[model samples]
Target: MSRHDYFSQFLHAVWHGESGHPLVASLLAQPAFAVYRNTIFKGCVDALSANYPAVRRLVGEQWFQGAALAYARRHMPDDACLIAYGDGFPDFLDSVDAVRELPYLPGVARLDRYWSESHLAADDAPLDTAGLHAVLASGRDVQLAPQAATRWHWEPAYPGYSIWNANRDPGAGPLSGLEWHGEGALLTRPEGQVQWQPIGLGACRFLDACRAGMGVAAAAGLAQAAEPGLDVAVMLGELVQAGAFTSFH
Candidate 1:
């Protein structure tokens, strides 16, 4: 076999935990290779761990690591996997019927995955209306960019956020018995820090319009239409305060 092909196969097997054929002996003999494998494995676990701390906390570190390790070592990434991981975890969890009892587990994992992606997402300056003139000038045609920073979306089943947030901070809140009905939340980072909040159905529609590239005036109407009694001023303030809009001018 070609040397390049043989080496590539050997490395893939080492990282993926598949049978290495004859190259396993060479890989084990080299101290650097052993260290490299350990480092890569630990790094993967650490990244996965950060993305699913609540899952780890819920299932305990030992069991979580054991399961995570088994999965991480086995699965081949879909594409260029460096920028993102855990893409399959939600599906993986869903398939594990045994864990179906923890229905919220997959959802929580999904949120955690979202948080990680948002955190690592490309940084950008969120638009802001610091002056009254900019607000007036914006008139009604303004629209938020897809990259606009904003607080997290919140839904009825959002006790999971509280539960997840609690574990991140010290002695924050109760972790158990926080389950609720349906949940829909939005998390945006207007600044460097991430903020989360619950959104009403109408508000969701409004944001969806903006997210879909609708203009402010049009989005405003959409929100108001969704809920006739919607307080536009209040909703705007909440979105602004939560760091939703960017470049109001």
Candidate 2:
């Protein structure tokens, strides 16, 4: 094998402990090597910790660090930039048998990931009143901004949204009861900062339809279908003010 391949395999074995020592097994015995390995693990753990603060807060530092190290060992960093690391963490949480009792962990992690993604999304100008007016005059389909991100997760068994929100805001009071509700989160970069809003169920459908390239009327119809009493005009106005749409084509 090429030297590069050999080096890769050596480091892999070191990180995963899946095989015998690398070519320089004696070197691995050095205290410095141990420190290096630990540093790498710590870095990965730190990144995961930052990305999923809510998860860490929910699970406590010890449990979170353990899980983070295990996950890092199995799923090494694919990108040099750690900002987007742990993209698969929510799914990973679901697979962990230990966390099965806390089934809401995955959903909370998903929301945490959403926040990180939105925060790192490219800067863009949000659709404003004049843009909305132009779209209204054209009478065409609309699409979300490239930086806009929207997701919905609902579990009848758990209150994922409330858990996420409570943990996200430091001063929020502890949750009293586990009430289940469908939650919709929308993220957009407006004025160079990522802003997120918890939207209503009907509004979630509306955004979904709009993102799917539906015109205002059609999207509004979809929203109203989900919520019969929904006010399409008002909902559209609110979404526009929230900078949800980029342009109508």
Candidate 3:
């Protein structure tokens, strides 16, 4: 093998704790290699920990660090930059046995991922009230803002949104008895800060329809069908105020 190939193989073995490579003796003699390995592993651990603060908070520091390190070893970052490194960590959390009792952990991770994604999304101007009115006047289709993210997964099974919101603020005392219901989350970065609000099933469906390029009236119809007593106008007003749409055509 070429010198470069030999060096690469040596480093790979050191990383995975395999000491059988031909250059293992040489690498073992260098103390810096061990330091480099530990630093890389710790960096990955810290990145994943930051991305899933809610999960870390739910499952104490020691538990989180152990899990994070294992996860890093299994799934190294695909990119050089580690800012959005834990994109697949929610699924990883689901596969582990340690958190089997905490069924909401995966969903909390997913929500945290969404918050990071929205914060990194490209900046776009939200549609103003006049623009919204003009589109409604023209009776055309509407599209959701690039930053807007909506989900309808937290139902009777697990209160994902409630759990996340309660723990998002470190100082927000212990969560009281959860008001179990079909709660959804709508997230968007309006003024450089990612903000998420609890929404209803009808609102989520409406937003989904809008995402699919449905006209205002059709989307409203879908929302009303999902919830017979839904007030389309009111929901639209709330979404508009929340900066949910970029523009309507």
Question: Using Cα atoms with residue i matched to residue i, what is each candidate's TM-score against the true structure?
Answer: 0.74, 0.86, 0.86
Mark the regions of model 2 whose C-alpha exceeds 4 Å error after superposition: 18-26, 29-31, 137-146, 149-157
After aligning candidate 2 to the native by TM-score, how far in Å is the CA of 246 from where it should be? Answer: 2.2
Colliding residue pairs in candidate 3 = none
Q: How does each model score on lDDT?
A: 0.67, 0.76, 0.77
Per-residue CA lDDT of candidate 2, range 1-249, in tens? 588877876677668644454565766767887778888888889999999999999999999999999999888888878888999999999999999889889989998888888778655555667866776667655554333543444444566778888887787789887657666666665676666666677887877776677666777788889889988778777777766666555
Estimate, for each residue in 1-249, the C-alpha lDDT of model 1 and write its tens digit: 688887777768666645455666566667787777877777677767877877888778987787677667866555445447777776677677666677667766766766766777767765555653366465636666545334344445545565556655465666667656554566777557665655676777788887788877888898899779999778877777676665543
TM-score of 1: 0.74
Residue 231: error of model 2 in Å?
Answer: 1.7
Ranking by TM-score: 3, 2, 1
Better of 1 and 3 by TM-score: 3
lDDT-wise, the better of 2 and 3 is 3
Best by lDDT: 3
Lowest summed lDDT window (length 10), candidate 2: 144-153
lDDT of 1 at 142: 65
Per-residue lDDT, model 3, residue 192, is 75
